[model samples]
Target: MTSPTIVTAAMLAIGDELLSGRTKDKNIGHLADMLTMVGIDLREVRIVADDQDAIVEALNALRSRYRHVFTSGGIGPTHDDITADAISKAFGVECIHEPKAMELLAAMYERRGMEFTEARKRMARMPEGATHIPNPVSTAPGFAIENVYVMAGVPQVFQAMLDALLPSLETGTPVLSRTVRSPYGEGDIGAPLTEVQKNHPETSIGSYPRFDGKSFSTDIVIRARDATVLGAAETEVIAMIEAIGRSREKHQP
Candidate 1:
């Protein structure tokens, strides 16, 4: 049987705090796992300061190269929040207060008896022709223009926005992965691992080394969209490890 087509995606993390080390980013990994579950391969990740030129450049580049581009951060009420404007420029469209977004924000503030100040209203602005990505955690919504999806930077809001947006996206066959942890060091298995990767071109083999202060071990993970290919590759990996074990046992004093 033929393998399903792969859907690729890129992530753009936008915020000066992220770059300055003031705020640690927790969205990329979440998005990666979520996207993978829905058959989208996250190919690239970029972190740009909250600058219009940077955001626009990264957005245009990623949107052109990947099937989807997910951006987190810089979509808030503060003056520094310029993701909406930058996205508009990147798509060559005007920025405006989207009616639906305005209504949502207005209702949210009214419920709390707080004035919908202009600053808070800024959250309603989006690139013209953009579609809202619901934010259940906060009234301010994210948006999607073309292939670029702009989301909140706050972890909770970002997760909520992603959860809402994913259902509407087109997904491919979910990728499957198997991991084998061995007490053997990576140095001992690196050569055979390379051979295994070459033999199984349809699967991706990754060797991750772990050091636990006193000793070293390796985790061999095999990934592929096809279950058959993945199983076959995993078998080869296990056999290679067994062979190495036998060789070591024979040489023991």
Candidate 2:
């Protein structure tokens, strides 16, 4: 029998603007896809304000609940960027200034012929005993404290950090996925999909509806790790979808 390998992760999107809906959160979807690709399920996502208390509380809550905790936002040069400090306090570690980050900042300043003030040096601070997560787009970098990963708020920088950090993660067997499109609506296919789920208990089957020019159709997605099982389920799904399509085709003039 194949051993079960399902891991859970939590995402903490920090920033007052996101919580206030002043800025829409995009990190969650990216994180969800990336983590899922590595077979680590994204089980929880929380958006918190820039308040220190809120950050600390969210950190504690997420870390305790999942094997991996990923945090995005508020680690910039601005004063409102306090996620690093808040998380460091939550973990009882001092936020130390990293020499590598300082060097990077200094080099950037020199390259631009600008004075590297305390504000620029501000990017060097990270939690003590933390390892830097590389930013492919920018060198300011993020850090990882235990299982918690502190990432930048900028979408491009955050994506870079994830690319660097993901390879080092303890990933399970890659999840295999298949999607089948049906002209029929989700409600119409629900019963058959439920039967498919029952037959293959480990596989996850989901139905999503989309609108075309004239009508709406459902897309059935089945995901699982074992290739053989996924193939069997996929075959069943395709047959069902084709059957629906043919029926619709015959009905149309």
Candidate 2 is scored at a TM of 0.90
Q: Estimate each model's TM-score.
A: 0.98, 0.90
lDDT of each: 0.93, 0.87
Candidate 1: pairs in clash: none
Output candidate 1 Cα RMSD: 1.0
Q: Which stretches of candidate 1 lie over 4 Å from their true place?
A: none
The most accurate candidate by lDDT is 1
Alpha-carbon deviation at 22 in model 1, angstroms: 1.1
Candidate 2 per-residue lDDT, tens place, 49-138, comes to: 999999999889989989999999999888999988998899998998888888887998799898988876778899888889987686
Give each prediction's root-mean-square deviation over alpha carbons. Answer: 1.0, 2.3
- In candidate 2 the C-alpha lDDT for residue 54 amounts to 93
Evaluated against the true structure, the overall lDDT of model 1 is 0.93
